[model samples]
Target: MDMPRPYRSVLYIPASKERALDKARSLDVDAIIFDLEDAVTPDAKVEARDTLKAALKEGGYGARAKIIRLNGLDSAWGREDAEAMKDAEADAFLLPKVSSAADVEALAAIIGKDKDIWAMIETPMGVMKAEEIAAHPQMKGFVAGTNDLAKELNCRFRADRLPMITSLSMMLLAAKAHGIVAIDGVYNQFKDDEGLAAECAQGRDMGFEGKTLIHPAQVAVCNEAFSPSAEEIDLAERQIAAFEETEASGQGVAVVDGKIVENLHVETARKILALAEAVSAR
Candidate 1:
């Protein structure tokens, strides 16, 4: 099995801001989303595209996965944006407001199958059709756009996120079922470390691979939150060892921390260790 890529802190940098892009090179982030849609103003769209192209050509991202967020295909600059970045050395292309499998298929056709496609599950239709979209061969991940989803649902944002529970669960289930990574939406409040931490923990518990971030300050917190704790690593090692010992004895289960550990549990424990190693290697 392929190890999961660490996406605990996916930072979004506006393509129009050269200095921001420059600063991002040194930040300790797992991934960077060079945003071309909402972050770039209408007047600066063309300029942002040019700037992003030049930045990609320079190439100093190192281990961080480079992703470019494209505007909606219906937007004026969408086609041109894809054309500009088609040759760029980015990891994936993120399509905004993806509502159906056909939307992903159309973009995949335009961008070709070499690059991974990530869909934004923000709209009601997008949530409803998430399964079809997640099952697309070209789609590598699903990003929950909670801000837009909130607007579409006409629900108020709350710290508890009670309003978004169902939608988030749907996206998570779809991604998990399809074996694609599911990333939680941005926390928005960059200064609220406590709030961000709580949200990050919540996302992690919800089976999200990571959280999208709007500011660089949120990187460390998100990384720390999503990573396997030292205690967790220790437990995983113990679980694996016990399970193996039991299997050698012709048993199918073992006990770890007063709980039963089976083959499937061993698989999950191994994955946790694999993820930790992957992140450390990066």
Candidate 2:
């Protein structure tokens, strides 16, 4: 399966801040979410939309994939946000609080079929209906909204993330079932480098394609977690070589370094190689 570019470190920038938008060009993030929602104040929504429009047209995001996170579908900013970014070179509309397939279809109608929809499954309803939400044809991915999820669930935040783990895992399963990407929520402790790395590792182990990042300081940690390690690439190459050598005989599985390699393992190896290529290009 071909993975879409891994947005392991998706940086959120308030669209109203012109300087921050300009500075993002030098950052090493995989994607940028120019916010028209939570990051911008109600009074600044219009200005932020304008800034995002101009920025995308001017190529402010550099090589990072650009996503415009619109306000909720019920809000006034949502429709206008889609309009302003309609012609802008945004990769997708990061639809906030999408609780069902209808919500995705609604955005798909506005954004058109070619442009994709990245849904934020933040609410209790969203978590309960994750599989249905991810079943949309144009749904490209799901980004976990743990902060909002905690708020909705009325749970206190903790390092263990026990309250949010089930919801997060549900998203990963749903995304995988539908062949869509699943990304973890941001680590709020931006200054705690070690803590952030641990959270990234946890997300990676849970099968998340990447993590939503809040600050530039978190970029390297997120990238490192999602990127293929040297050992992983080496193992992948060895598996491929082993499988190729037995192609004429057509064995059910190949063995490399005493480790059995199956077709499923080969798929994982291919994905790692693809990630390596994307990271190198970035």
Candidate 3:
């Protein structure tokens, strides 16, 4: 079945926070990730699960996708979370610390074909088997967990992200190869708007469809980063027009704004136009 691909801003909110859940219904984010894993304490897991179930029943996400990030499979509450969310009216079930294809298969067995599964590639083991994990037939997409990955690898965050760039890039490559959306990890420092913007730009350049956001403030930045700017849309239009002229068709390639534009460039332009339309509709 063809699934809706809302790979823009996936906003994570604690399942226990009724206020945040209520606010999320009105946000412009592509998805609302109701978190029942790391965000909820063990003592509150049951309560969070119940609250999320209730919210799901309320049905106010509008056009935005609805998702739930469950605890790792190894956790005590993982199975319970899956059971609770299997029919929670969510778009997908996010499995954290997805280390192997089996992890996804198990979740898929529970989720069945009704709900898609979004796997998190954060741990070293998960990174090592990202391709396999993403290859699962029921897998919908991937969300990079940069914070957990950095901690596991003991690497400091740098502008270049050299330490983990290979893993991050490989995750994106796997998702693309499997025809699934891939999202960059959340930027932890919400106060550093400049830094966050830079990372968002870098992620987009790295082939990420969008970004996982921690705060509502990060939504605007994520949306802007993944969106095609006015200048870019204009250039895409010119390139597409030039290509349709037939004069440039047999040329194999043509120069748009002094830059070589090819069939691949046209594909990218179409995606940009699609995103522009999606944004405009939203």
Candidate 4:
């Protein structure tokens, strides 16, 4: 398996705001999405595109993966946005409302195979076709757009997020099946640290690689929540040691912390350790 990239907190910065773009350079985020859609007003779309081009040209984002979220191909600004940023120093192009494999193919055609493509699975159609979209050769990741999904589903938002659970699960399954990263949607309440923490924990349990953030304030919390805890690291180390000892003795199972440790369990423990190492290295 490919080593997992540390994507604990992917922050979204509106391309239209120069100050926000400048501020992002100093933010401790795993990745920054320079957004040209949704965050940019329709009237300011062209200017935002120009601003993003210049920002990319300036090139000060260190280590943090730089991504550009373009308007949908169906939208008037989408093509121009992609064309303008084609040579920009970005790691990926995030396409909003991607509902099929063809969408990925079409985007790959425009952006070329050199850049990664992160698709937003926002609508009902997107969720339904997630597998096909994920299987696309050019797809690099999936970002769940829970707010738009809620609007499309006409479902009430709850603290537990019961209504969108199915859609989230489907996206996660597809991402894991295809070995691509799956990012949870943004938490609307940026001020609600408690709420954001809860949601982050939920997303981590649901197997999401990270959470898409709307504010820099949420970065630390999201990063901490997604990363393996110290206790978890210690436990994983113990599990690996125990499993190795047992394997040397020709035993198929080992015991760690009064729990049975098998090959599958050891594999999971190793992944946790690898994730911790990856995060620390970053």
Candidate 5:
């Protein structure tokens, strides 16, 4: 089996900003999304792509997954953005406001079938067709675009995110089903570390591999929330040891802290340990 890649904290850095791109190299982030979409003004779109391409060529980001978020094909500069950076040193290309599998296919057509595609599930139609998008052969991830979804759905923002749960679940389900990464939306309040931590905890509980961040300051909290805690790491180890003992004895289950450790639990426990290792390696 392939070792799981940790996506605990994915930060959006505007491609046009040279300083921000350089600063991102040192952040405690698992991935960097070099944004060419909403973060850039229309006039600077082409310039941003070139800047990002040049920056990537100069290379210093290390092992952090470098994802480039492209403008949608519906936009004037989207095709050009993709074409210009198709050969850039990026881990993946994020398609903004992806509404269906066809959107993914269009990017594939432009960038060729070998490239990885990550979809932004922020529209009502995008959430509705999430399964189709996730099933695309080139699809590698789904990022929740909660801000846009709320705007489109005409829903009020709540700390509990009650309005966005259904949509979130749909996108998450699609990603989990297809064995792709699912990232939670940005927690807009940059200065409110408490709120960011709370939301990050909520997202981690909801099975999101990571939270997409808007600011560099948010990286520490997001990584802490998503990573396996010491207690969790201990428990995972115990579960694996106990389960292995039981299996050697020709049993199908084991007990750890009064809980049953079946094959599925062992599988989860091993993944937790693997993820911890990945985070440590990072």
Candidate 6:
């Protein structure tokens, strides 16, 4: 099983703000979402696209993935946003409020299949139809638009997020089923490490590829949460060694920490080591 790139900390930077874009170049984040949707007011949306295009052309973001969040196709800005960014230097374009496969298809039509898309599963309808969306050929990722989903569901923002679990799981299942990246929504309490850490743990345990972020302060915590710990890395290394030895002896199994290590376990162990190396290289 091949693991995709780690999106452990994807920080959203407003494309309209020059300072924010410049500052993001230095942030210790795996990916940067150059947002032109919710972060920009109508007056700034058009100009922000130009600013982002220029910034990407200037090229100081290093190895961090660059994703541009476009406004909805139904909105006034979305089409033009796509048109403006089609030639921009970005790994992918994130579509906000994607309801079904058609929504992704529409964006794909405009942007062309050359670039990929990350759908924002924020609405009730979107959650229900997540499977079709994830199945889209150009759809590469899913972002749990938790804040918007909560608002749409008329649910309280509880720490446990009991009300939103079903929807989140649905999106996760769809993404994983389609071999796409599954990213958890933002933690608004950027200044609260304890709260952020807890939420990051929840997302990681839920098998999210990473957590979408709103602030630079949240990166370290988010990165740590998704990363394989030292102990985990050590165990993964030992598991690989043991499994290799077994293979050399023509056996199909090994044991690590007294647990059965089979082909499945070796695959998982390899992913852990790969993720650790990716984090270090980032």
The C-alpha lDDT values of all candidates are 0.93, 0.86, 0.86, 0.92, 0.93, 0.93
Q: What are the root-mean-square deviations of the candidates from the true structure over C-alphas?
A: 1.1, 1.8, 2.2, 1.2, 1.0, 1.4
User: CA lDDT of 34 in candidate 2?
Assistant: 82
For model 1, the run of ten residues with the poorest summed lDDT: 1-10
Q: Please, what are the lDDT tens digits per residue for candidate 5 over residues 166-235?
A: 9999999999999999999999999999999999999999999999999999999999999999999999
Model 4 error, position 189 (Å): 0.8
lDDT of 1 by residue, 146-265 (tens): 999999999999998999999999999999999998999999889999999999999999999899999989999999999999999999999999988998899567998899998898
3 versus 6: better TM-score goes to = 6
lDDT order of candidates, top first: 5, 6, 1, 4, 3, 2
Q: Across residues 79-168, which tens digit of lDDT does each residue of candidate 6 receive?
A: 999988998999999999999999999999998988899999999999999999999999999999999999999999988888999999
What does the lDDT come to for candidate 5? 0.93
TM-score of each: 0.97, 0.94, 0.94, 0.97, 0.98, 0.97
How would you encode candidate 4's per-residue C-alpha lDDT over 1-282 as one tens digit per residue? 346679999999999999999999998889999999999999999999889888888988888989899999999999888888888889999999998999888888887887789999999999999999999877889999999999999999999999999999999999999989899999999999999999999999999989999989999999999999999999999999999998899956799878999889889998998899888888
The Cα error of candidate 6 at residue 159, in Å, is 1.5
Q: Write the per-residue lDDT of candidate 2 for residues 82-199, one digit (tens) a residue.
A: 8777777888889999888998888777878888889999998998899998888888889999899999999988888888888888888899999988889999999999999899
Question: If both were scored by lDDT, which would come out higher, candidate 2 or candidate 4?
Answer: 4
Report the Cα lDDT for candidate 1: 0.93
lDDT value for model 3: 0.86
- Off by more than 4 A, model 3: 1-4, 247-254
